[model samples]
Target: MTERTVGLMVVAIMCVLILSRGMALAAPPLPPVPADYADKHMPDGWWTDPKVLAEGEKVYMGQVHPKVNCSNCHGKDGQPKKKGARDLRDPSLVNRFSDSFWFWRVKEGVPKTKMPAWKQYLNDEQMWAAIAFEHSFSHKGQAADHAHDEIQK
Candidate 1:
């Protein structure tokens, strides 16, 4: 009700805003894509290819190969279908991993996890295509957190 009270309230609000901004600035940046994990040569324009994307979509949907059914765990829209499955739609995580990382993980699979190695059932190209599909949900282009130089090579 008083001018002095209003001024004090404004100052408190300003202090909170300034502190939040500082905290955001103090946060560490996302790590770069690992050098060894970068792809040697990604299929040219494969990420943009309709047919390839279609195949990748099929792989995501578990249509092409029974073992390649990502949606069974990751959900159709990148949400986790089960309790431990990660929400793939999280850009903070998805954008941090390079194409090669995705490919390697798909090929080798994660240890002590539900994810199984898909290399035995699918060839390299199909795996790459599937990565493209997974990345499609949250790719941020060149400015994305992960380095995909190998994917373009």
Candidate 2:
């Protein structure tokens, strides 16, 4: 209505906008990911697969046949903070490699990591089956291969 009133209102709105923009820019987000990565891609029918995920649930709950329960350290919910435990919900690592890579990791084991070789405890079928279950926890596919070496290899 009045020039002074309009100017004051404009100034107040500008200040509010400036403060909000500053605060938004100042707040740091937790855990960063690469620009090319899709942080979360959990799919449906994850728990429906009796062969992999359902059996993986059994392994997570410690009722799996052939034993070697994963729950002892990784926790029943697939969430663990222990030294060797991995963030099963994170697709970046869970979906890092192909099914074969997962099989190799389970059988041959991850070097220097807490992951132990399961070749002694589980057979190939069981291992791949477990990986299939892991898919329930991981994204559909691997992240973009940013490096030429990775693409070549």
lDDT of 1 by residue, 1-153 (tens): 899999999999999999999998883553444565564334778777778778888888988887679999988877888887867777766755566667767887777798889989898888877777777666532112234432321
- Candidate 2 residues 1-153, lDDT tens each? 999999999999999999999998872432323232223222334334554565655654556555576666665545675777776666555544444445555666667787778778776556655655555554432222212222111
Best by lDDT: 1
Task: Output the number of the TM-score-best candidate.
Answer: 1
Error of 1 at 139 (Å): 4.7
Q: Rate the local accuracy (lDDT) of all candidates.
A: 0.72, 0.55
Clashing pairs in 2: none
Instruction: Tell me the spans in candidate 2 whose CA falls farther than 4 Å from its real position.
Output: 1-48, 65-67, 139-153
State, as a TM-score between 0 and 1, how close model 1 is to the true structure: 0.65
- Which lDDT value does model 1 have at 110? 72
